[model samples]
Target: MSGRTSAASPAWFAAVRPVLAFSYLSLSHLATARDSHALAALAVGMIVLLLLAEPLWHRRPWAIALAAIAGIALWQLKDSAHIHIALLLMPVIFLLLLAWLFGRTLMPGHVPVISKIVRALEGGDSEAMMAELDRYTRGLTTIWTVVFIAMALINLALALIASPGGLLARAGIDSAWSISDSQWSWFANWLNYGLVGAVFAIEFAYRKRRFPGRYKNVADFFRRMAALGPAFWRDLFK
Candidate 1:
């Protein structure tokens, strides 16, 4: 790990950073105006930046050229309100990416992703300090991987059945089962956030009961998470 924190990272870059990406996705789905669809463009671009910032920084000249090319491409599509369709595919891509990140850590030799984050946030013997906590963390990592993959699959199904330009509609195929664009948005954008937040909250409440001394409450746990600092998160995937 480089142990280097830069302006590229802050508290949001850590545990709950998915909210940063997911928020844009939700808003993009609610879009009804052309300019609003532009939000999708911005959202997707930011996701790229978030994931590749370090590599981009390491190759500054090439990054500059790529950014310029991307900007021009976006400008060319500014008139297309169909950009919001990207939101239909956004969750599938984003959640699968998250699934991969967590799932990979669960492989035989590697540390579970949640276990690593807990250790970093604790800055001590997080797993050892509590009985079976390591086992719990490993299980939690598996849960996240499964959860994200499930969410991605649901989004894919929704994208396929959604009308007014969905996969089925575009193919001139009609199905007895289908949903409206707004209805799809209702799930992909709003319901998905509720589900994710509920999961996090449920975990916190359960942890409070299971691991009483580690945190005073949920807020305290989040505060500890924030205090992990940028360096910990910057090196997380590496």
Candidate 2:
């Protein structure tokens, strides 16, 4: 597979995903008071599309049905605080699930997640390269597992302290630790994603420094990774 062109993602999707993501996240903050049904519906639709993108792209029947159900539910319950709470839980659940996925692969008999990806990407062509990456990949997988768990815990904590109606405030505990709803949204919806991106960016930089000569340049590395195709990603998660 050529790094530059093989099975690459669409340029339009690359641009639009971020825009839709931020648009919905920003609207979540705006809808914090649970007063803007229209705004909430738009955000919910964007989120549904984002979540269903992979299955929709693959034209899966069950995913389509689930998306439809989610769409109807969001439309009906857009004004409810329950919708907001559910949205808040999405990040937490997603992170913890990912943490479990990565952590499980590190068990005694199972292949570590990063090791498996590296092996698939390398196409079983080089023993020496695989040997070099084995330990590093395992350690990197551990780091990712830890990062995901830590982020999920932090997200949960913030949700608990989110004021006006969060667990702490609802219990009549007006402590200094309480955070505003808007602040919680900023961290949960925005900064959490940003931090994940930052981690990837920093790791990319360090990988280039540590594994010099493995990739031609930054673009080359990204192209090679992207060439892995959507199917590889879907199956890896499964």
Candidate 3:
């Protein structure tokens, strides 16, 4: 019984860690505008997770200390309105990071992200339909890169327009051209996800028409994509 428990410990921790991390992130976002205490707790939790769970931080004690200090500072300032600055920048940074991820893979000698994903879905058999799959997946990767870039830009624009005494406002731009904070929040929090889903649906439709042999139906394609989530994350982190 002791031996079995010892063997299962690491496996159980590996399975639970990501779920906890994701839940913390989701709750952080949801509580950002509504509850300062929750946001602060989430921020500290994330910092602790990074320090304890991430391999990169294990060897860098300075980095861990700095991160903890930053987390503590943020937590201390959570009750202030200035904390909203971090909240506003979160989506913008996330979109930009995604754009960078997809764009970086398009460089010379690098396999496109979408191509890697499709290859993973196809059981790592690149030789099965090399020519067609390569071309289509590269193009799909470009599409995703462009989509993420566009989303990032739109989010930035909305944030700028909604901010009081922002660059545009300081430059004598008309108030009529500026957006409200609520409007910006709507786009950053909700419509951004909607637009991404819309793009995915549109891309799937285009793929169906362009590559009939790839998937039998939209449902099958989405199902396969869903199944590739773990592989995608593994490839992403690697």
Candidate 4:
């Protein structure tokens, strides 16, 4: 390997990224809300959903898959909740997990991308390092870039086909019934979660681990937050 870090990286980016993304998504949707009541209801529902899903994640394969499918379906339904935040950002989480699980296996043998970027950012690009970065990127382009492009196309197709407006409408909410503001808010949130969930599942399964480090503080925080109860708690009583 080009270089090995004796210690895991700080949780700087991981801690902040999700919050910012979630805020952007929520605010963007709220701006489209026709009534304040709807926005408030959406905020409440979204918080509840986030609390519910956070603990269920646990870096599991099935949870990841369900998250993706649900998030995508919700997006299709035009839901505006933060549930999609988890799903949409699933790719990053998967990368982090992969890096933690198999960091040694996924990183480049020499002059890794991080080092090069840091060096460039700090204005310290030696000729040898540049050549190494070039070599590494060239190899990466040859081996994986095309595959990623193909995967992107596949994801797009899946998203379109699985859209809530398309396949999920078959679930058959009564079209004649006037949807209340709260109901609309709830629907928007569900759609967001479904789309995000789908992305997470897909990325977790397909993407290579490039992020480096063990579980960070924020990940642990969210993991615990998500784990509010047993997965079948709601079903067991029935």
Q: Which candidate has the highest TM-score of all?
A: 1
How high is each candidate's TM-score?
0.80, 0.79, 0.70, 0.26
Stretches of candidate 1 exceeding 4 Å from the true structure: 1-23, 32-43, 46-59, 123-131
Deviation of model 4 at 222, angstroms: 19
TM-score, cand. 4: 0.26
Please report, in order, the local distance difference test score of every candidate based on alpha carbons.
0.73, 0.77, 0.66, 0.40
Q: Candidate 4: where is the Cα deviation over 4 Å?
A: 1-16, 22-130, 141-148, 167-238
Candidate 1 lDDT over residue span 120-178, tens digit each: 76656543674377789999999989999999999899888988656677668886789
- Which should have the higher TM-score, number 1 or number 4? 1
Estimate the lDDT of model 1: 0.73
Clashes of 2: 0
Write one digit per residue (lDDT tens) for candidate 4, span 1-238: 1223223324352344456447544643463344333343343334334533442333445556765665555555344443333332333343343334322323556443333333333244568755655665444433333343444343333322332321122244434324333333333434435654675455433422432232244455346434533332222212
TM value for model 3: 0.70
| lDDT: the better of candidates 2 and 4 | 2
Candidate 3, residue 33: the lDDT equals 45
Collision count of model 4: 28
The segments of candidate 2 whose C-alpha lies over 4 angstroms from its true place after superposition are 1-20, 33-38, 57-59, 123-126, 170-173
Clashes of 3: 0
